[model samples]
Target: MENIIKVKNLTFEYTSDEHTHRAIDDFNLNINEGEFVAIIGHNGSGKSTLSKNLNAILIPTQGDIVIDGMNTKEEKYLWDIRQTAGMVFQNPDNQIVATIVEEDVAFGCENLGVEPLEIRERVDSALKNVGMYELRERPPHLLSGGQKQRVAIAGIIAMRPKCIIFDEATAMLDPSGRQEVMNTIKRLNKEYNITVLMITHFMEEAVEADRVIVMEKGKKILEGKPREVFSHIDELKKIGLDVPYMTELSQLLNKDGIKIRTDILTVDEMVGELCQLK
Candidate 1:
């Protein structure tokens, strides 16, 4: 698979009133095409900052970010880079630009100068992709939180980005809303073959990803398949991060001498492990 995103020794800082704060410190990463990668971190850990840099919302103070072969630092590639990697922020309301759902979904395509017919096709397809086609004619403000977020996602997909960076996209939702967005995210990666870079605080959401990246104080401390990374329960806990519930429960069980598998990440895996003990 092609490397869609590459960050090399990237450093980013915010300067205010002559005081500089390093938000990302020599961070490096690579995400493959069609891969679903989740970034988890405590507040001020620089996950969101990294996402912005990847999308070229902020340039690197040092190092480079290459997205789909386009370097984000190059001024000429700014628009193309953004088109290649669209962003969906935490609040759906902030992303919705049109009054009606379908119009909002079509907004990105229109801005990209897609023809009228193609824009219509892309908007409808994007809405259907996020399971929001049935409500396309409704006012966005009337929809539930989950539906609104899906509309926001639809807008990004309509632009046909190769990769989507979701910056705490599900943070404002209830459990059901989060699940709705998660289902849409999985479908986007698995069926549509779109790469996903999700920065989220929810451990369950991270567990669903192909890989989990743990960050702390502007640096990546851990990166692996979800099971491999979450297996370090103590290390994650020390960093103010939580593993999937099943992984944590299994660890406790092993401590109590029950001898269950420590790598369990889901309910089904835990159930299977316990059944073997009987």
Candidate 2:
């Protein structure tokens, strides 16, 4: 697969009248096409900062970020870089701009100067992709949190970005709402072949990712498949992060001499392991 995102020695700083605080420190990463990657970290760990840099919303104070062959540092590639890597922030309300759902979905395409007919087609397809076609005529403000987030996602889909960076996109939602968005996100990656870079705090959400990345104090401390990364329960805990429920349970069982696999990441896997022992 092609490398859709590449970050080399990325360092970003937030400067104020008093002093400058570094948010990302010499961070490096690469995301291939159609990969579902999750980034998990504590509040001040720089995951959101990395997402912003990937989308070119925040330029790197040092080093470089290249998205789909376009360098984010180059002013000429700014719009192209953003189009290649769209962002969906934490709040759905902040992203919604139009009164109606379909109109909101059409906004991105319209800004890109898409023709009327093509824009209509993209809007319909994008809405259907997020399971929001039936509610396309409804007012966005009237929809539930999940529905609104799906509309926000449809807006990005209509623009047809190769990669989407979700910066704590499900943070404000209830459990049901988070599941709805997660389902849509997985479908977009598996069915539509869009690359996903999800910055989230939920360990359960990270379990669905193809790979998991753990960051701390502006640096990546861990990177592996879900099972591999979550297996280091102590390391994650020390960093103020939690492992998936099943992984933690499996670790506890192993500590009690029950001898279950320490790397189990899901409920089904845990159940199967216990059944095998019986």
Candidate 3:
């Protein structure tokens, strides 16, 4: 796998009134191309801070961020770095530019000096990718939360970035809205082979990720497949994280001597296991 993003000895801090708060400490990570990575953490756990650093929105006070082998700290490569790794913040309203959804989606390529004629094609293709082509001409303000977020994502896709970093993008959405956004991201990863780094607070939401990276108090605490990481229910619970609902039920069943698997990540899996009871 090609390494798209690398963080070596990355450390960050925030200072107010000369009092420094360590946000990240010697955090190091390597993210591969076309991998669906879910970053889970509680509030103020430096996950958001780490997401920002992925594309140079926030540079490490120490160490460096290399995106596609380009140093994010290099002023000359700032635009290129961003072009390679696009970012989607939480709010749809903050990301949108044009009144019409299609035009907003074209904003990125247009800024990159992509030919006007080609921008239209990219915008249309991107909207179609996210299942938003039908709403391309609709006013962004008139769309639902999920629609708005998809348009925001289409805007990033129009940039044709190699990687997309989402920072708690579903936090403000309803369950359906969250599902919509998550589905779109997953589709992009699977269908288009786009690298996805999503910061999330919902443990259940990450069950489908190719890998899950758990963060706690400015450090990388756990990293593995969803089943492997979530199976450590005790360690996760100790860090203020919840297991998948199905896994929680599986744990209870096991405790009751039902002999169930703790690695169950979905309702269907739990049901299948119960049906196999002898």
TM-score of 2: 0.98
Distance from true position, residue 129, model 3, in Å? 0.4
Each model's backbone clash number = 0, 0, 0
For model 3, residues 1-278, the per-residue Cα lDDT tens digits are: 89999999999998899699999999989989999899998888899999888878887899988999999888899899999999998999999988899989988898899999999899989999999999888999999988899999999999999999999898889999999999999899999899999999887778989999999999999999999999888998898889899999998988999998878999899889989998
Q: Estimate each model's TM-score.
A: 0.98, 0.98, 0.98
Candidate order by decreasing lDDT: 2, 1, 3
lDDT of each: 0.94, 0.95, 0.91
Off by over 4 Å in 2: none
Tens-digit lDDT track for model 1 on 142-206?
99999999999999999999999999999999999999999999999999899999999999999
Select the stronger candidate by TM-score from 1 and 2.
2
